[model samples]
Target: MANADDMLKVAAERTGELAAPGMSSRPSRKVAVLACMDVRLDLYAMLGIERGQAHILRNAGGLVTDDVIRSLSASQRLLGTEEVVVIMHEHCGMNGGSDDEFSEALAADGAHPSWRLGAFTDLDATLRAGLERLRTSPELSARDRIRGFVFDPETGSLRDVESD
Candidate 1:
């Protein structure tokens, strides 16, 4: 069976165990968190966030892409999120990866895209750049509170990244 099938079976076994019956769609904490899609880091447990408390967005490397900005725009404007937190982690796949290789692979498959793979060599610098992008983006309603961090999966700890 597929992994999704296994997940479905578990969901069936625990139906309503994670349900929030009366919780509002808006985040109670009025914050939005963007993080890498790393299985080792559980955002809820790491950040002490519960369901309906904050908006959590995840993607490769947790770099601030255009799509992330778009989501943040809606998160702050429509969902009332006033703070933003970005978390990239140590040993991320995107770290030390090659965008050229990724693009060439896509080209071999006869695909062409406008966006480049956000690969970075320096974790802290990348985090700082992403934080700066968030801070300068007029689309985000609350920019002053935007912060970035680098998670150490080995130690299960997060180190703050200073932005310009």
Candidate 2:
């Protein structure tokens, strides 16, 4: 594979114009999905939605941080999307670590991020925490249908998380 610089150049060279240029900013699914930034997770196939169907907000643990709340507020008020889906997964790297350990690790690299690392003990409980954050967030336009799921990459399926 090419180096990072070459990768961008190669990608640009092979890229084509958008086929759906006139697509609206509003999500077609009327939902916003908060998911882990794990490269293996694909929202399209998991939810069976097409491009421009849903607003996907990805972060390390898919936790509802302040930034996510900010985005979700705008997604509902400005954009035409509603509802929230939190998809955490099995074998997440966020599991089995402490915030202090994560902070110290970053400190060694001369970077001290202020945000919580959101490491957790239980995957299902972590997923539930994210779900509850959306539920309690007053700015979310449609909290009635908030859902959480734990994706099993091994089984290639999702297990529903019971509401808190």
- Which candidate has the highest TM-score of all? 1
User: Per-residue CA lDDT of candidate 1, range 6-78, in tens?
Assistant: 8989998986786778879999999999999989989999999998899999999998999999999999999
TM-score of each: 0.94, 0.88
Candidate 2's TM-score reads 0.88
Name the 10 consecutive residues with the lowest summed lDDT in model 2. 13-22
Show pairs that collide, candidate 1. none
Which one wins on lDDT?
A: 1
Which residue pairs clash in candidate 2? none
Residue 93 in model 1: shift from native, Å? 0.8
Model 2 residue 118 CA deviation in Å: 0.9
Q: How much lDDT does each candidate structure score?
A: 0.92, 0.85
